[model samples]
Target: MDVTPVMSSASTPATGTTGSLAAMAQQAWGALSYAARTVGVPAGVRGLAVEVAYTAVHLSVYPWGLLDEALRPGGVHAHHRTDSLPPYERSRLVSDLDGSSTPVLLVHGIVDNRSIFHYLARTLRRRGHGTVQAVNYSPLTAFTGDIRTAARDLGDHVERLCAVSGVDRVHIVGHSLGGLISRYYVQRLGGDARVDTLVTLGTPHRGSAIAHLLPPTLVPRQLQPGSDLLRELEEPAPDCRTRFLAVWSRMDQLIIPQRNARLEHPDLDVENVRLEHVGHMAMTIDPEVVHLVACRLGRTRSPRDRIAPVAAAG
Candidate 1:
């Protein structure tokens, strides 16, 4: 089977390898328990249990679900094939972009691939941006683990794209965890030089209370604030060419305290839109959020561009 992701304007990239064997085991246990409860004991249950147990045993070998890519000749996982695209797809993308440097990269959130950006990318393309590339990465792995790797990978991709497309820099639009991942890339991995704009929709910048409410075994502790992942996100870095914008909603269920959506960087440009009655995931593909991102992307100014008016008025 082709394990590579389809090269959609909205497909996730390949996943990085995982490190936590214990966490994988715990996730397996929970899945098994849920399956047993759903089916109950009987001949049916026994048959299902056998399948479930078989799956559990294999989960250790394939945490990210690649049959052989995650093991053997691995430190970084091997690249696999996607049913959607041939290896030469990158060449075709260059041709599609027509050698013009469109200044946008869309990265999706946890458990989501580029598909989350399908509607938004199509709309933006209609608006006449030069080119758009989606960062596709698996989410089952730890945020700090695979995500960090993803950020680095993105940096490499950006370099290659710039070289091929003759674009000096690209704007970045991220939704939910994608936003966080984008921030990490720009701020920590020195992606600021290659990116011009950073727009985050429904990102949880300060960590989520909903994450805290979940059982520790069910979700990694690193998801909480003060954890390694959050701490890395909070670390200070030198300024770059990238401008920042964040679109927040009042009713984001996933981002508890809602204020978690706020960007802490005083140096980066920040904007907040009050999205009423919109949930976290909904904002990813919301038309209003997409408009806000496009508008922000079109602006060329310092991060402090609009701060004086609010401060003087306050």
Candidate 2:
């Protein structure tokens, strides 16, 4: 017997084969779990999940509203070419300025283009509000420079809107960081005279801690609590003539401790409207908010009435 034991040619290593199959199964399960968490859970959750996903996408890939123009055909341009147009042509609003009451200038927040206001703009128009124009600032600008520059640009746009509409004062509606910009214009840039009413939705007037999650860019830094820009904005504005209405949501994920959206300045005329279960982005398109804004714009309030900060549950 040359070979003590003859190995069976057809025999397989059962333990090794079983171990490999188990490893593959585990890997497959991990992939499936990841997919479910990313796609399935977010789809079901809806509110905060949608906002978070949108924000993440905006920050990571679509910063500065890139590809937004592609999404919206013939919508408002990211950069208005008023400089090229004649005064007569430039003065015209999206809707007929003459027929509308007070012209409304809509300012979008960080990394957002004018398209974000499409639904709200249409709603305002349907409700018979005046010229609803939206402005888009460079997302990179917000990340690189002071917000005051955007406020200055806003001032320029406001002046143009007023000049074209033949209105002495225009109403301003700002969302998120745009609210901060409008506030800076009103408080620091002497825009109170030109702006009659300012309505802010989900704006962090006192700044937000969640800003820390963003890169330490100029505007993000400015948005952090106790930043210089916010401190300056907090200063007394005794002469500010603008009436401010702050609409904030309890479910807003961006503005941590959401009360930061309230305008707490003593000298300014401010009001707080609390919205429940509304995400930050949804505020711009909310029907109840739009109706409330229309009512505010439609009626004329006395100075005494505008001075007090009133809180209402929405």
Candidate 3:
């Protein structure tokens, strides 16, 4: 993505001042008020019951997502073309000041397939997003695949998508283990050059204890709390250009302490969005998560807009 600096003189009367103390104070007070209003867990009984039911639904849909989706020549379908949208629909869908047509790819968690993204993909298209795709990594690969190996494969996939779509950069949204894999690709494998934004939902950025409870496998071993693979990811990635957003849920059952999902590396630009009442498997279908993703992905990439969205839902 091109990094240009500044707004036109008409919008920002002051030439050099990027921020002001008074404005910050008002923002802080507003954030505090919003946080106070949203303090609760698991969205109450309704959310938990729905989460349980969705697991079975997702399982039944899993087989349908097993086959890799064929790459389209133009990256998106007929309706996703923004120019073809009717005026009213276009106004509702194109929220960005610069109208980014960035292609989005959804990566699923372990033992899950692209089927998890059915709701999210359709929602994004309705929001006027140009291209949305989902990829599946085989569960059989777990016996031989480690994080770096999977990351290498992911890198190749991103390159192909960029080429096929004829776009300079793409945004990635990874769920659970898929997030970790995408992170390794961006930070360690130089995928930052191609991936504009990387959003992780319920990913274990600090590693998770659940891996230790499960039987050892090539991938699970790498996901353990203190594994060498996780340690490597902890290393400084100051040069990575891709923006990071880690969306973690308080009710996620698979991530041992739950808090491990937050990405706190000092070197990277990361925004952490906290969620409540959503579980691991249910995150993709959750309305709050789907909306947050659509809003973030729809925004134009500018240096100024990259720093906000803190505790968006508390």
Of 2 and 3, the candidate ahead on lDDT is 3
Q: Estimate each model's TM-score.
A: 0.60, 0.68, 0.77
Task: Give the runs in model 2 whose Cα sits over 4 Å from its true position.
Answer: 1-99, 300-314
Find the candidate with the highest lDDT and give its number. Answer: 3
**Ranked candidates (lDDT, high to low):** 3, 2, 1
Which residue pairs of candidate 3 clash?
A: 42-277
Q: What's the CA error at residue 136 for candidate 1, in Å?
A: 1.0
TM-score for candidate 2? 0.68
What digit string (tens of lDDT, one per residue) describes model 3 on residues 1-314?
55344435555645234457667788889756643443343354556677789998988877777643543333354445557776754775456524346778888888777889999988886777667888888776556667788889988888887777677688999999899999999999988877878999999998888888766887888888888888998898865678888999767778866789999998888999988777788888888889998888875475434323322322
Candidate 3 local lDDT, residue 71:
39
Q: How big is the RMSD of model 1?
A: 18.5
**lDDT by residue (tens digit), candidate 2, 97-129:** 432457778888877766667677777665555
Which runs of model 1 end up more than 4 angstroms from their true locations?
1-100, 142-144, 213-220, 300-314
Which residue segments of model 3 deviate by more than 4 Å?
A: 1-42, 67-89, 92-99, 302-314
| Best of the candidates, TM-score | 3
Candidate 3: Cα lDDT at 16: 31
